[model samples]
Target: MHPQIFGVLLLALAPAQVFCIFNRRTWGARTASSPLARFDGPASLVVIHTTNTNPCSIPSMCKSVVRDLQIKNIASNSSDIAYNFLIGCCSGVYEGTGWDYKAPISHNYKDPAIHVALIGKFDESAVPTHMSQSLRALISESQLRNKLKNSFTITEHKSNSSTRKLMVKNFLQGFAEYKEQVNDLLLPEQRAATSTTAKPAVSVPSSKPSSPTTFSTASDRKATFATSTSKPTTAKNQFFYT
Candidate 1:
């Protein structure tokens, strides 16, 4: 090999870096009466969400938040927590439905998006530095674990038309930066040319057999749905947690 070309190749092939797995536990989770359905198929979208609950920076409070969410989801007759992972302000990541497993989350389009949520609301307060960093890290790990292509779209919950009420207001503006950061981790071909958050949502039919999935709102008591015959349709931009 030519000396100069070999040196260039060495520089291009940097050391592969892997992040530490966040601590995961299910003690606070309410077991779903039935095993979670298999949704571990190939994914290319990641949806970000906030509990929209009181912000809890403390670890104990965060655990309770997770517990309550699981309880709420189960009571609503969901198979389990609808999201694949949840992050506390300081507590790292808590396992939810987990990867490749179907989460009964997305509203309109549901081809290939994975759902991830934060423990507290971020519409008003900035997402703490720790939480934001960890969220990105977790997403990166998720893609690697699922063997997904390096780049996947990251979107906020409110981006969906029917679920605008579920939006985390303050956090919406910063989604572009988040998208850039996520793209930075991708290989050249996989990097997104632009953030897809502002793009209008294209609603199709509910991918699952049930009615359109609803985001958990503050006052929604009966959020669960029985079986429905809604047809499935694909959105223009297949996104996270569609």
Candidate 2:
């Protein structure tokens, strides 16, 4: 090739390479670091909910949704890394949602939700099996790790309780749904064979667990934990959200 042409080609390709580096978060990419604020937690499960966003959203735009989730989840004041996993429309795979500051962009061992997308925008009338396949696989893996049953309980995002235990219970319900949705993605035969029959309900203890150090809430948080004693209406309900 001519030297001049080679230089021009490299210049053109440079833009394409930068685009890939920014857009794809699977092999690992990221935008601003704040929205990914949840990476600092010890949580094990990922909850994925597909909003009815404009289907025309390109990959870069879709990442904005991720940033939004991180913002809301943190704004809601839950643990960082709202979910340990994320599955979306890319190739056939799952991507870890939040990241440790150490593993900023790429998903080698640091990320979870490997090789699958749980949701994708498709023709309403006919959906591809890939969506369910990835979804259920991710769920099953989460459940197995938690040692929970396949058909466990799940709460709608709206579910709430006056107490922290109830809040945890509600979160667990979401966890169960995450497990079921992913596990059900298996082939019907596989689902039927692998799926367990008796699933458990929300497993909250009758009383609150031992209280941790408490702090007062700002406008964002409704409840704070200081003293162990609490009544539904008395103690603040400010610690968390849906």
Top-scoring candidate (TM-score) = 1
Lowest summed lDDT across 10 adjacent residues in model 2 is found at 2-11
Over 73-109, each residue of candidate 1 has an lDDT whose tens digit, in order, gives: 8788876777877777653455676664667674333
Q: Candidate 2's C-alpha lDDT?
A: 0.29
Indicate the TM-score of model 1.
Answer: 0.57
Q: For each candidate in the order shown, give its overall lDDT on alpha carbons.
A: 0.47, 0.29
Which stretches of model 1 miss by more than 4 angstroms?
1-26, 159-242
TM-score of each: 0.57, 0.30
TM-score of 2: 0.30
On lDDT, the leading prediction is 1
lDDT (10s digit) by residue, model 2, range 1-242: 10011100000011111001111232222343354432343223233333333331234444555555545545565333234344444312223342232222212222232222123333232223333333443333334333223343332111122242233233344232433332333344444333333344345322211112121212212211111112111121122212
